[model samples]
Target: MKILKINEEISIKRSVDNGTEEQRVVVKSIIERVRQDGDEALKAFTEKFDGISLVNIAVTEEEKREAYKEIDDDLLAIIQEAASNIRSFHEKQLHPSWMTTDENGTILGQKVTPLDSVGLYVPGGTAAYPSSVLMNVLPAKVAGVERIVITSPPDKKTGKLPAAVLVAAQEAGAEEIYKVGGAQAIAALAYGTETIAPVDKITGPGNIFVALAKREVFGDVDIDMIAGPSEIAVLADDTARPDEVAADLLSQAEHDIFACSVLVTPSEALAKAVAAEVEKQLLTLPRQNIASQSIENFGAIYVTDTMEEAIDTINRLAPEHLEIVTDNPMELLGKIRHAGAIFIGRNSPEPVGDYFAGPNHVLPTNGTARFSSPLNVEDFQKKSSIVFYSEKALKENGEKIAAFARLEGLEAHARAIEIRLRK
Candidate 1:
């Protein structure tokens, strides 16, 4: 980790990867093939990309049962408990459809409706992430999405999806699991195939091809976001533990080679201590190669003149994951204006939120935390504005509405109101 003195405004925003022209062209072709060839295209792509021949695109009940058998009883209980916690947390975010009536008999309100269907893409290949399955699927289930589907690549050797991924999806209440991945899976989710029906929205993370495929089918179907690399920033003082801080930073670093882990503090001694600790810990990390490259290229520790300046720098960074590990973390909570998720004190590490802390781990990355948010139940639901004007209310306000419409030079709109008023 490199240590530097903060002299001016700092930004950790990485340039968004929009994919190369060749990748975009390939994604477009894949989507068109799925639309034209349907299930056959899906099978062909699966065989080509995933190295598996699938007699059935969808996972059977027997397969799910076998998956449960593969997972240990203790792990199964843990998954179930995490599911309960996640469900409970998101259930609090639900709001009922509401309306209000005026004395003149006019009614106005917003109707909240869950999406009819949703597709969650779980990344699979070198590794499986059951936590991701829980984070993505449980929110939709909580939001009352009627049909939740999951698509993940199958392991080449076993020709089966990871048992853990399967178990997590089922525990999260998603029964429709498909063994497909990459751009083709995204296409199938966006536009229906013979086996997989189209969804109203798609949510999850994948490789560059998956991201490009999502971008290609965006207007046709809603997507959660174009997520960037993972990021973590720690704002700490002298009281913070150096070893714990270093471990928290490496947790994000091991995710990707581009993942960023930064530390902002006013304590020069703590800064040097954490920098040393990070290097020592990285020597024995399991993903040392990846984490080393990430730390080498994107990791940094900035020494600020004051804690206020440190907070200002963190606000400018607007990191995806932030940890405030000062002596009085709560006192500075209100000063933080931007962060996808804030872990307070040394006890609340970033992975706690990632796995079992009940908050969605799918958060905004790069500088998007400035304006975006973590994946939530609301992302699975849509809003429709309701309007009703009584005869008396229309007569009272129709002329004013017509005038407002005409002010915009929309004659047809004004006539629509005036003709109703004439009646």
Candidate 2:
């Protein structure tokens, strides 16, 4: 990790989305083929990218039962517990359709409606992330989404969905599960095939190919966000523990070679200690190759002249995950303007939010925290504005409404209001 002094200004260059010209072209071809050929295109692409041919694209009831059997009782119980927590948290975020009526017979409000259907893409080639299944599915379920579909790549070794992924999806109340993955599955979800139905929106993280596919198919079907590599920025002070900060940094770094882990502190001693601690801990990680590469390339420690400077630098970066290890972490909360999720104090590690903390772990990455947010129930729902006016009210405001519409050169709009008034 590089150590640098934060002078009058903060300049930390972050990595952008992973997209190559070749990947985009390949993904485009895959989407077009899926759109034109339908089920056959899905089968062909499954074989080509996932190295498995499937007679059925959907996961059957029998497969789900088998998956449950494969999972341990303890793990199932844990997943259920996590689901309960997630449900409780997201339930609070659920908003009801509301309207207000005035004595003059005017009604104004918003109609909150859940999406008819949603598609979740869980990555499943190397290791299955059961946690992701819970994080993505539970929110839609809480939002009252009627249909939730899951698409994950089948294991090459067994040609079956990972037992954990299946169990989690079932527990999270997924209406349908399909044995497919990559950009092809995204295309299938966007434009339905003979086997799978189209969805109103798609949400999840994937490889560069999946990211680009979502970008291409965004307008056709809504997408959560074009996520990039994982990142974490720890804002620590002298009172913070060096070992703990280092461990948190590596947690995100291990995600991928492009994942970033940074530390901003006002104490030079703490910065040096964290830098040393990170190097020592990197040796023991199973994903050391990936983490070390990430740390070497994108990781750094910035020593600021003051705590305010550190806070400013953190806001400038607008990291996906921000861990505040200051003596009074809460005191800094009001000062933080940009961060996908904040982990305050020593007990609140980044993984707490990632797994059991009841907050959505699917957050904005690649400095997108500046403007975006974590995936939640709102992502799976849409709202429509409601407007009503009595004849008396329209008569009272008719001229003003017509004038406002006419100001924009919308004579049709003005005449529509004028007609109601005249009536």
The 0-to-1 C-alpha lDDT of every candidate, in the order given, reads 0.93, 0.91
In the range 1-423, model 2's lDDT, one tens digit per residue, is 899987654533454564778888999999999999999998998898778988889998999999989999999998899889988999999989999998889999999999999999999975889999999999999999999999999898777889999999989988599999999999999999999999999999888888899999999999999887888999999999999999999999999988889899999999999989999999899999999999998898999899998999999989999999999999999999999999999999999998887999999877778899999999999999999998878988999999999999999999998987776
**Per-prediction TM-score:** 0.98, 0.97
Question: What local lDDT score does residue 346 receive in model 2, on the 0 to 100 scale?
Answer: 93
Give lDDT tens digits, candidate 1, residues 101-184.
Answer: 999999999999999999999999757899999999999998999999999988888878889999999889899999889999
Q: How does model 1 score by TM-score?
A: 0.98
Instruction: In model 1, state the lDDT of residue 212.
Output: 93
Cα distance off (Å), candidate 1, residue 84: 0.9
Q: Positional deviation of 245 in candidate 1, in angstroms?
A: 0.5
At residue 269, what lDDT does model 2 achieve? 98
> All candidates: CA RMSD in angstroms?
1.2, 1.3
